[model samples]
Target chain A: MIEAVDLERTYKLGDSDVGALRGVSLSVAAGDYVAITGPSGSGKSTLMHVLGALDRPTAGLVRIDGRDVNTLSDGDLAELRNATIGFVFQSFALLARTSAVDNVAMPLLYRGMRKSARRKLAVEALEKVGLAHRLDHRPNQLSGGEQQRVAIARALVGDPKVVFADEPTGNLDTRNGEEVMKLLGALNADAGVAIVLVTHEPDIAAHASRQIQIRDGRIAFDSAAGRDPAAA
Target chain B: MTVLEGFRVALEALRANRLRSLLTMLGVIIGVAAVVLLVGIGGGAKQEVTSQVEGLGSNLVIVVPGKFELGSAPTVSRLQLDDVDAIARVVGDPNAVTASVTSGEVARNGTREMFTSMVGVTETMTTVFDRPVARGQAISATDVDTRRRVAVLGSEAAEELFGDVDPIGRQLTLAGVRLRVIGVYAERGSAFGVSRDGEIHVPVTTAHRILGTERVDALVVKAPSSDRVEELRPKLEQALVDRYPGEEFSAVTQSQILGTIGKILGLLTLVLAAIAAISLLVGGVGVSNIMLVSVRERTREIGLRKALGARQRDVLLQFLIEAVMLTAVGGIIGITIGVGGSLLIDTFSPVPAVITWWSPAMAFAVSAGVGVFFGVAPARRAARLDPVVALRTD
Candidate 1:
């Protein structure tokens, strides 16, 4: 489970404070397929970062699997991310000049796994993403959709409790984007992996079993509530 | 990460910029080679001097008239013939001492004439210098007492003056004085670029009479055994100083001379090695420079690794390993080049060179130390980078 109660994040811009997230609260159960949608500058990405333990909130409580995020040191946070959470970036962020299998096996390396054993696990993860044939292809050698698949394999290789996807298909074509969404939906439905996807596209949000809309750093709508507070 | 994995990453990074890595390593290579080669030359010079002195005799000691100081002119010369007789009496051994006076003079035989060094020695020269007549009889004590005009030709001098004819009993003019050659010396190789085979020897009394010099220039004494030489050294020195009163002279054993020369050469090798080590420092700077550029270029990769759970020390160690690997490989190449160069010099040149095991080993250690010393700043810079800021960079 992932939870954020009244989480707030701020940035100091010269002389004024800019709030990326203000009084935002959300919760996701295990095996939940949740999509977080928002306009530009609406705190959707900030909430993803806070929930994934990638960044700390300026104020408010953020917890993952019932453990307080604020109580963890930097090293402990990295361990939490490596062992319990995985991230899929917008730009793929796979190491250039490195093979797909190596990128997928990277997270396992930090766990002190031997190279051969990690590579075997990485191969299985790649196979699950339909990239078994492209294990040796580098980021530049693969198509945009294939790169995203490699990134997804990297995220799943750690067997994380929650996967945070930040605009995972932002650079792909419409067909590839639909394919990636279908793959993420299956990971949640069949493998029972929790996914917190952040995007601005309505069609992408519709693929999830639950939807939450954010605006001006506040939660504007929740599908579970069956009503939009902004409209009410 | 394991050490092997760190090295693998470093090796790949270096291989990415092969030309730059090689150029950066050049400084360390030259530094190590210079250190090894200079040390070899210095060591070889000392060895040559030691063997040359050993060839003369182990127990030989020399008493020269004057205070000896390197690169400075001696102002005192008070050794006389009476002092030699007094020292001989103090030793109380007739076969253990000889007195010699030397000069450069022109010798003529028919039309072949050459300027050669001539030494006027007593009959004990054979025991003192370990050079005995090879072809004929050495001068006897009677010859020294009689002050006879007889000469001994060095092997080279004989070859120059009398072509195929025997030098024994041949008459040669030495500085306008004609003397019959009684013996020809055996061939001895060159020392310090001068041939030892082009010398002539005569009786000390004959040299004192003909050269118009009453003072003895050199007095050589042979110890009865090697251990006796050390015990006699201080006694001879004290006796000479007491006899001369205010005059200065030196009575030095063979080992003392070799020790002085070895000390000087050892100091010179250390100095040259230090100067050469500066190049290795410069090479370390080169490593730091290239590593900093690599860190900047790979910022995104670093951020990704950090996101995947790499610690600060991991990044620091990766770059540090790369730096050390570069210099260590360069050091190995340098040692190879240095040893090969020394061997070539020893084989093809007049100046001998010897490569000691410690010299190359020391050079390698210095180069590795240079790597760690210069690599710290850049590695720390890489480690201190914020993953958020680094990931945002284009």
Candidate 2:
């Protein structure tokens, strides 16, 4: 349900030009689980940003659910992000001082849900992530793994069609990372939500149904994988 | 977001930084307090002046024979009894007009002596000026017509000469002439800082016989109504001119004095209000600075909200509401302190300090306006923040 053609993103660093993504194109259909594996500075994060409509491409056409992101106004893009896409950062960006439930309710709050209703749905989402008992605990009160779980619950609370997770397991231990990857696999199978995960680890990429290896802003390989897609 | 949600968020944020919020509100508190206190003092002064001036009687007009010059030598002019008579005749009512001859000297009763102003007036003076006798009776028409050496003592004058004893029917020497006290006038408060209670009143003919003067220093006329003073003043002036032919005299109306005093007090209020408004400006600046800091610190929050579908207007409104709320709270506190301060001043100080109804309202309005005025820049900065950049900020 997402498409990109000839995406090029460049940044001006004082007197020099830095091309984050140079002429890359990709597509993913609904209910798909894909992983973009690349080395550091290989443009995977930039591509995910473009796909999620969080940032505009310098020169490209990015269509999500058949709507051109480049042609959308800033407010329209914000609405699109709220309604159709969710993001999970590698840092587990929960509001530092707020409760897990409030963090989960953040996405639904943007959808204009009433406070009580947002709380109810946020509790259910936290239960799905196995954090229901820790709903009132702040991020600081929780461990790194638990914080990441709260972030995952926040991403899924809005029930978006796609989730853009940038290194979702990058900050977790091996065991916690495996558990998180299994959760993503179960979500894809049970809920049929499309997920485009960016990771540098081959083991992490191995858990996706399809893998695209990116090198120097180009797709080096695209292939279907079948290693139980959850065991990595 | 709904207004209630916006307020809740603002309250939570402020509660999270209680010290900063209180510090920010300090400016508004002082500003509103200054507004209220300054206006209250000004209003009190006005009321005090009005009461003192009104006590001199509303229909009373004084005609002095000299030009009133400030910081200059006095140029004296002649005002005769004929001029007073002409003014009385032309006033169309003898009951509304009276003239006085005045002199100042030491009076003695046996070994007791006191410095006193001596006023000589017709028997109709009591009716025209509303000075009724407190003890004994006033000088009769026969006393003025026959030029009898009969005196009426003011309250202070009697007490100074007789030491609380009855001075009525007693003899006192004034200007080397022995006169019997026929009555004691009631106590009249200070006028222009001079004690009217320290004066003595007697017949005009008797005063002329004793002080050796036919010239009247002043003439006091009462108009039938306050509104008629303007209509009667020119006619009275013309009559004096016709009778004297070549002399000059000026009629001073109560309205003119009232207007002049009002203007002076009004200008004083304006000056004080301007000085107080500086505090408001300072408060506004404080609000602006605090809001700027808040916007900077909440950059991530703004980005998150924006990414969650909050419009630019919503973000702008949130900050603006916070600023307004801060100032409004300060204003309420300031008003409370100001009113309390005014009441304390009134209780302890001699000058009357009244808190008018409009002062609090004005203080609140000004403080709120100051909040909005200073809140604009920070609110705009918040609204214009780039969500992508803000989200990515560490």
**Candidate maximizing DockQ:** 1
Report the TM-score measured on chain A for model 2.
Answer: 0.94
Provide the TM-score for each candidate, comma-separated. 0.89, 0.81
Fnat of each candidate: 0.40, 0.35
- List, residue by residue over B1-394, the lDDT tens digit for candidate 2: 6777777667767777889999989988988898888888888878877777776667777777654333335446477666666777777777777778889978999999999998999887998889899999898889988999999988999999999789989999998889999899899887545788888888988998887878788788988888887787777777777766876666777656665676677788889888888988898899999999989988887877776666777788788888888998899999999999999888998756889999999889888888888998999999888877777776
lDDT tens readout by residue for model 1, B1-394: 7778888778877887889889889988998888889888888988887887776567877887666555556554566667777778767786778888888999999899999988888898887778877898787788888988899888999899897899899899988888889998888778778887898888878877879877677788888888888788778888898987766677777777777777787888778878887777777788888878888888988877777777778788888888898889999999999999999999999888998899999889988888887787888888777766677677
Please give the lDDT score for candidate 2: 0.83
Question: Please, what are the lDDT tens digits per residue for candidate 2 over residues A1-232?
Answer: 9998999999899999888888877788998999999898898888888888888999989999999998998778878988888788888877775789988887776567799999999999999989879999989999988988888888888888888888999999999898888878877889999999999998998888899877777666777533222233
Instruction: Please state how well chain A of candidate 1 matches the true chain A, as a TM-score.
Output: 0.97
Interface RMSD (Cα, Å) for model 2: 2.0
Q: Identify the candidate with maximal lDDT.
A: 1
Clashing pairs in 2: none
Per-candidate DockQ vs. reference: 0.51, 0.41
Chain A: TM-score in each model? 0.97, 0.94
Interface RMSD of 1: 1.4
Off by over 4 Å in 2: A15-17, A169-185, A201-206, A213-216, A224-232, B44-57, B64-83, B92-95, B98-124, B137-183, B187-218, B225-227, B239-252, B339-359
Docking quality level of the chain pair in candidate 1: medium
